[model samples]
Target chain A: MKTCYINGTGCISTQNTFETDFLSEVTINNTENVIYANQPSYKEFIAPAASRRMAKGVKMGIAASSKALKDANLTMPEAIIIGTGMGCVEDSEKFLKSILDNKEEFLTPTSFIQSTHNTVGGQIALGLQCKGYNFTYVNGAVSFETALLDAKMQIENDEVESILVGGIDETGTYTLSLHKLINLVKSEEDKPYSVLNSNSKGIVHSEGAGFFVLENEKKESSYALVEAVSLQSSLETEEVSDFIANFLEANNLKISDIDAIVLGNNGDVEFDDYYDISNSLFKNTPQVYYKHLSGEYNTASAFGFWIAANIIKNQDIPEVVSMNALKKEAYSTILLYNQYRGKDHSLIVLKKC
Target chain B: MEALKQELKGKIIEVLNLEDIAVEEINDNDALFGDGLGLDSIDALELIVLLDKDYGIKLTDPKAGKTIFQSVETMATYITDNRTK
Candidate 1:
């Protein structure tokens, strides 16, 4: 079986991830219930005419995918797979508003055309002029993991030598208000929000895009190997430990085999117990968490994936993301577990190349 | 006529999202597609919607767009003759 290696990664998050080194310029924002992505200028990667019609999500996808492809030194990939929970939602909001404002008459097509969930994947494929396999997964929190698993399986099966896989989501004003109404976003009373051990019930919502170039052969720029990925649609807080352990066992690993654990603790007081449950299992292992910097979104775990890959490649953990004082001499095998609102649980294992 | 032409330029710029091009840069006779403005078929659709929504002018014959949208000058003239709003 062929091995799938993560050779390049590009992430645009609430932190300065696209321009800065791996977690070099990181800040913890606790004042706002909704955080926006720290977007880099797209003039270098996208033309003005092309980008004028694109929503923030599509632009982020293009910029991140460009950086990933460039980092991999690849001009074209055999496949482009993307995952987005709320794809081009800004455009969706605009189109919907237009329908109401115009009474569904004389509606323009630009926003409507760009509002689909597959726009990111289609736009990336159009930009690359790559007519290969292009697919977008939109399964809520497990979206990115589903795309990652698809790419890994294709690489293992020798169906494709290289693939560009990514997860992208963007915020919209109306959507944020809706999420806030449902108490999915932390209330203003819960300001000074922190991901770990927080007294809040809702997450600090945000948006971002993370892209990776996966290939069959390990190269000099290879970060880590895609060892395994497992997803569960629903699991009780108590079942998380066994879910993780069974995943590790299927991959011939144990809790001790994990050099570090990246936990998705978004400070949602109700759902974070899922991580706490796993925390008890890997108490002694070096722990890492990133929602404090990236904020909580459906594809926020893609940022976690980027962090885990960097840890394995650089063999160094940023002090900002460290969850525990426990340290490892070298991070060889890293496990990433993420879920949203106690559902769509995912476990991904990455190993040193 | 000049005011209408200027208004057409502003509307085109706003509707097409031509951020880099100012109204003054777009000559009255400059082509809206192909070599001049570099707009594609998608932009063409936007222009059609703009004409219908703003001027209340519906170009039922799609072939008329090729001549009417040849330039801002042509679009302004067409609107001048056919505008209901």
Candidate 2:
């Protein structure tokens, strides 16, 4: 089986991650319960005529994919696959509200046309004029990881040498209001959110798009060799330590072998313990987390993946991302573990090239 | 005619969520698609809704919008001609 390598990556998030030297001017958002992406100059990445029909999610996906392709020095990929949890919610909300508010009297097809979950992936393929394999997964939190796994399978089977994969989510107005009503949003009293804190009941909801170009060949910009990636639908907090141990062991790795461990801790009191258990297991290792910067979403784990890829490429862990003060002498092998709402557990192991 | 054109631009901006754009930015003779205002297939749909919702015009085929929505002037003319309400 051929090893898969991430050649290029692009992110559009609450931060200005699309512009050149974007990471230099990072803002740590602590107040807002719902944050939207600091958008890119879509006109640069997309033609105005083509962008008119794209929903925010589709626009974000296309821009991110275009940036990824440019970074990877590739024009088009052999396949396009994407993962989105609440796909095209803005368009969906528009359509549904129009039906209710107008009594279905004279509805048009814009929202309904763009509301499909696969629209982003379909739009990307159409923009690239790529007719190869296309797929979109809507399995909540595991959506992006499922896309990665499918891309890996294709690479191993030699079905495609290069693939464009992404995870994207966009904030919708009424749906976000519904989330707020359910206390999915942090209450006013829940100000100054901290991911490691134990007092929180829910996360600070945010949205972003992260895209990567995965190829069979290792290049100069290859972040890391994708050692292995595994996903589980359910697991108890107690099972997490052993889960990591077995996952590492299966890959012929030990806890001590992991130079740095990147975790996904969304600050929810109920579910953050999953990270706590795994943190205890790798407490001595160089530990890091990024949801505070990326914020929490179904596909926010993609941000963590982006962080892991950068750490492996730069061979230096960003001090801003460290959950603990412990530092590693040489950042080599990294393990990224993330789960959402006590489900969709994922383990991604990466090794420096 | 001028009122209808301004109304059409307003509805288009509102329905499309052109947060960065203003009504005055759209000229009546500006091409609604392509290089004029840079709208695409999706914006066409949103404008299609604007026709139905505001002017009581229902166009079943999106292709019919090509000529009808070429410009604000064209859209206003079509709505004036075919509006049911």
Candidate 3:
């Protein structure tokens, strides 16, 4: 199989991941029950005419993808694939609300037309005039992982030399309110929800977009090499360790071969133990986590992927992203593992190019 | 007629999110669809909603929208003659 190299990455999240160096400041734990992304200036990247009709989700996706393509010095990729859990959710909410409020009369088509899972990918393709392979994955937490896996396979099989892949989601007030009603969002009383240690039963839900360019050839600007990626639908808490062990064995690697382990601990007291399984297994390895900074969403793991890629390239873990006191002199190999409520388990390994 | 044109301009700027364009930039006879104001089919839909929601004017045929939404002056004239609210 051919190796896939990370050409570039652009992320817009609850933290300053856009144009900022790997986070250097201490992260402020948000106290709100439902958080929102720390958005960048869309006008800087998107033309006013093109942006007028776009929902927040599409704007974020376009901005992030543009940044990634520019960073890679790529004018256009051969394919564009995007992963979104609730695509153009704000538009969806607006269209649905309009239908109900207006009794389905005098309704406009702008929001309705943009409220699909593939809208992001379609918009990007339209912008670039790229007609190659285009697809969107919306498989819950594994949405981003599926996109990543697809890009990797296409590169391995020589179907495309370069591809732009992204995971995007935007939170709407109505949806967050519904999530709060079902206790899927952290309670308001849980002031300053901590991802590592919290008594909260739910997550401090937020939204973001993370985009990357993957290529078959490594360049001087390459961030890291994609070593391997594995995904599982569900896993018992007891099976977490063996699942990881088997993944490592399949790659002919041992537990100690990993330089650092990134865990997805989102402060959901009920399910945080899922990280404990991997944490204990790699007890001596440097531990890293970023959900405390990015917040929780279906595709939030993409932000974690950004953190891991940066770590391998920089050879220094941001002080704010550490889950354990352990430190590494040089991070050459990084492993990322994430799951949402014990489902959509994903493990990705990366090494410095 | 001028007042109605100004009101329509403000609504277009607000409804369509024309962040950079000011009210004065759009003239009364500036074509709203093509090269004059550079609006498109999506903006046409938004204008249709603006007509119904704000002026109580109902437009059913998408083709009829071409003449009614030709310019700010035309839209204002149609709204003045046809609005129910």
Best by lDDT: 1
- Superposed by TM-score, candidate 2 places the C-alpha of residue B2 at a distance from the truth, in angstroms, of 4.0
How many clashing pairs does model 3 include? 1
Residue-level lDDT of model 2, residues A1-353, one tens digit each, is 89899999998988777884536667787787777888887988776646665778999999999988888899989999998889999899988998899997657677788899999999899888999999999988988899989998898788999999999999899988888899877777888877777487888899999999999999877888778899999999889988888888899998889999989998888888898754477879888888888888889988888889888888787777878888877888999999988999999988888
TM-score of each: 0.98, 0.90, 0.95
Which residue pairs in model 1 clash with each other? none
* lDDT of each candidate versus the true structure: 0.93, 0.86, 0.88
TM-score of 1: 0.98
lDDT of 2 at B29: 93
Residue B44 lDDT, candidate 1, scale 0-100: 88
Write the residue-wise lDDT of candidate 1 on A137-212 in tens digits.
9999999999999999999999999999999999999999999999999999997888887987999999999999
**C-alpha DockQ for predicted model 2:** 0.46
Alpha carbon lDDT at A16, candidate 1: 94
Q: Which lDDT value does model 3 have at A15?
A: 80
* Model 2 residue B59 CA deviation in Å: 6.3
Model 3, residue B36: C-alpha shift (Å)? 2.3
Lowest lDDT 10-mer window, candidate 2 chain A? A20-29
In model 3 chain A, which range of ten residues has the least summed lDDT? A24-33
In terms of DockQ, which candidate is stronger, 1 or 2? 1
Q: What ranges in model 1 sit over 4 Å off?
A: none
